[model samples]
Target: MMASNPAILPGDVAREIIAPESYAAWDPLLDTFDHLRDTMPVAKVVAEDDVFEPFWLITRYDDVMRISKDNKTFLNNPKPVVFATREATEFARAATGSNMLVDSLVVFDAPIHPKYRKLTQDWFMPRNLKLIEGEIRALADKLVQAMIDAGPDVDFVKHVAAPMPLHVIMQILGIPEEDEPRMLMLTQQMFGGQDADLSGSGMENMTPEQVLELVSGAVKNFEEYFAGIAAERRANPTDDVASVIANATVDGEPLPDRDMAGYYIIMAAAGHDTTSATMSGAMLALARDPEQFARVQADRSLLPGLVEEAIRWTTAVQHFMRTAAQDVEIGGQQIKKGDWLMLNYVAANHDPAQFEQARSFDASRSPNRHMAFGAGAHQCLGLHLARLQIRILFEALLDRIDSVELAGDPVRSSSTFVGGLKTLPLRFASQ
Candidate 1:
């Protein structure tokens, strides 16, 4: 076993690396990643109290991209795909008889993954997306008008960023308009448990037990909610994604109850949250730099660059854990069979080796081939939809808003995963 000392991230640094609060403060966390890439990019993160077993942290862009593309060697199954503290894993075992409380596409490996993904794969493709463009534009128009009517001082997260993706996803899922709030609330509890504002638990410093309890409840809510939706869709089939999952089959059999629920949860949660994060991050960048904002406003052709850059800048869905299926070497370190590894997207996205002036937000950055949507088959399924939503919303914003700037301090979500700005206050002038 590797000794837990100065070699890898120190005990304190390892703990902070996984902590929610540390993620809230972006720069300090980047400094830690910068240090890791320079000294030990593939070092083990050892726990002092043994609350969790050690896992290698992959910091470099090349290493992360390699693991992401090669799903066979670095598989998602046989380990918790997301980082979980020892206490949380143990609690999950007791509660659900599994290391993870929820299982979804994010946790599945090949054969099974390919089959399940094929169910709704075509629905999210660019050709299908064109059919919904009018609806999206209409939503954008209504939302942008609402923002204009909302006065000069507006919380961008509340008024614009959060709702655009949420509504788009909900419409695609065949969920009723009235149920949108419930869906958003449930998602917040699931992904935002560490944030006091998002979790609604009324406690900021929650215990491991409390966090697990809240997460479990949210999962239960999502499962119960989607079960009914699944049943409805199966009975009265529609062209929506929920119908596809409800009627999907693998090996000539319907998906098991748990797998079906997992499908719905991933579709419902990851479907909207990550896009919202990128949208908010993009707005934050424009609000801070008026020149780029004016540039994009003058030349509408820069919209695609703006969207791509924001996706890279935020890199929501930060890290996904992959267990080594066999002995392999990466970044000058020998990794053994069955060892767990973290593909740190945030670190890779910011690596100077990959991105020039990695800190500066470039709306017109070229060759931006970022791993923000991940790589290979496991890449984010909603990527095209995310890009479309951001583009359409910004088009609407450019049409209505003459100028914009930050009204106050913007705050970020306290989560190491599925994170971006949660509170972005902006002052805008109507065109």
Candidate 2:
């Protein structure tokens, strides 16, 4: 076990916090982090049984901010950004001949990341998104109506939050409506496999090897499906994201099939999972604090605050892993070259030094520059679209929903990397 003292104690804590099966047990890690922030902000996280490398877990807001912004020093290229279990890492590397986690845009450094990001940069800008604002608003309205039709008591996660972004992203990508269910299913298998219901493979009781087997099967299905889609886009192009991906080039050359597959997978899966989690987190916060909900409902102007607060509060996309290119010092701690460090975004988002009342969910949090979408070059490409989607969806909900209450038990996804509520049951009264 890692050090039994200081920041993180040796126990089931690492498993509970970083493992997929224990994602539902949230507050323990948060509480431990609250202590770590003060005691040892950048402490080594040794896993149980030495199954994973001991990573420097940076929890303080300032340190995380510094590391994320200093892309030149704390590079994202040449490695995976999200820490994988050693077993999964070995299996993926063996199967793919390269680390599967090391392929995506988020895992690349300058020159490459910049070039790849530029391909679809203009498409996500506010002006471009403005063109789709009406369409999005209409979709949001339709989604809210669907929720209302589901009756007063609905699992908001299923009825409202989960489906809205999936439909929107699939539309933008020009995927068929019939395929939406399949896409969502694959997304759950990819991101929420830690949970029993979401994984579809009963990950709640599976060994790490079994879990990877499930993930491998899902990845195979996604690759086959997207390959067919890419070919179609090639044969008959359209003004959609899939078409954009199919036609994109870097350095006057086409992206390799594997990289292209990773891009599509990230967009399709991360797009919905992260957004849905944030939406559920926001709704959960609002549900818990009716006064805040009433304030936002009464004043539409507060919608942005609500959205930002939700992003910060949820911190859906948790930690990003960075490997040291050379020896460096961060937060007054020495980091050796080739070392793995976890920029724990959730911990950073709630750092007391950066945010006042960081533990409390304040809808009116001013100067809220949380690193929920990350910082610098690798900042989330879909951030604008995410914000636009959330704001529009909330606008629709505020117009129709007058009040909400917890209908039943709410459950968080059992995913260490992308954590949020999987089942958010709620009862709301319509306006």
Model 2 per-residue lDDT tens digits across residues 10-97: 5554555477645476777778788878877877778868888778889898888888888887887545577777777788888887
Which regions in candidate 2 have their CA more than 4 angstroms from the true location?
1-16
Off by over 4 Å in 1: 1-6
Shift of residue 127 alpha carbon in model 2, Å: 0.7
TM-score of candidate 2 to 2 decimals: 0.95
Least well predicted 10-residue stretch by lDDT in candidate 2: 1-10
Model 2, clash count? 2
lDDT of 1 by residue, 1-431 (tens): 43334256788889888898888898999999998999888888998888887999999999999999998899998888989988888877887777788888888899899988888889999999999999999999998889888879999999988998999999999999999999999999999998999988874677778888999999999999999999999999998998999998899999999999999899888999999999999999999999999999999999999999999999888899999999888887888899999898999999999999887899889889898999988998889999999999999998888889999999998998889999999999997
